[model samples]
Target: MSASSLKLRMMIVTALFAAIIGVLAQVTIPLPLVPITGQTLAIGLAATILGWRYGTLSILLYLALGAIGVPVFAQMSAGVGILFGPTGGYLFSFIPTALCIGLYLEKTSFNLKNAIIANIIGMFISLLLGTVWLKYIAELSWGAAFASGVAPFLIVGLIKAVLAAWIGIMVRQRLASANLLYA
Candidate 1:
């Protein structure tokens, strides 16, 4: 495809990823400690596949949609008030996460094991930021914040990262076959 067409494809992919995450937020795991959402998978895969700019744009678009009260946040909640919730840690960290994942995946040579490791690290960065944010905003200490925000998501995050890496590998293979990737 032409350069302009590729850019258009990236734009469409970004918008679609944002919408996918918005939808995923509605289907929650509903943990007693802190609710878990499928958004992590969407964010991870979006970053891993789209690269930095598109990944960041996808997250920004999701934020914009939620800000407009699209019921895109977890449990069908949205608007500015969503920031006041304890889960806002995870919510707000979505932006940094995409950039981190994009940078890591884009820079590193991706093998199955390495990609999974990188995926976990990237997800952990988001979870760490989220847990820290939860600490101050939720008035909990580091331990308590981790319990509430980070702990509950650990297993799910691992599982999601595995899936994201799997999808990413598949996409990479497809793109490679089409001779559409840079390296």
Candidate 2:
């Protein structure tokens, strides 16, 4: 593909993943502070398949949409207020989490083991950042923050990470074979 074509393809793919993330964010179980959502799973999948650049771009776009009052967040909540809300840390963390996973996949081979490890790393980083955010925003103690923000999501996060890794690698492989992936 020519340079312009490649750029267009990248743009399209990025926008698609951003939409995917937005849609996935709607799949949530309402909780007191941090709801369980499929957003991270989508983030992992996007990062693994799109690599760091486009994956991060996709997440950034998704966040931007939510910031501008799009009903793209968990339970259809949106606007800059959400960023200052209790769950905002987790939402904001998606960018770095996607970058971490995408960078890992970019540096290493896109295999199951590598994908899982990358996803795990990304999940942990997000959880840590999110926990801190929760603690301050909610004015809770560290233990309370972990209980409300991190503990409940641990198992679900692991499951999503594994699933995202497996699916992401599969998708990446297929896209690469079709010459549809960016470098």
Give me the candidate number with maximum lDDT: 2
Question: Mind giving the per-residue lDDT tens digits that candidate 2 earns over 1-183?
Answer: 798887888889899999999899989888888999999999999999998999999999999999999999988889999988898999899989999999998899789999999999999989999999999999999999999999999999999999999999999888877877764
Candidate 1 per-residue lDDT, tens place, 1-183, comes to 687876776677679889989898888888764678888888877777776678889999998888888988888889877765667777778888888777877787655665687678878987998888778877898888878888778898999999987887677667656655433
Give stretches of model 2 more than 4 Å off.
Answer: none
Task: Tell me the spans in candidate 1 whose CA falls farther than 4 Å from its real position.
Answer: 175-183
C-alpha RMSD values across all candidates: 2.1, 0.9
Predictions in order: lDDT: 0.79, 0.93
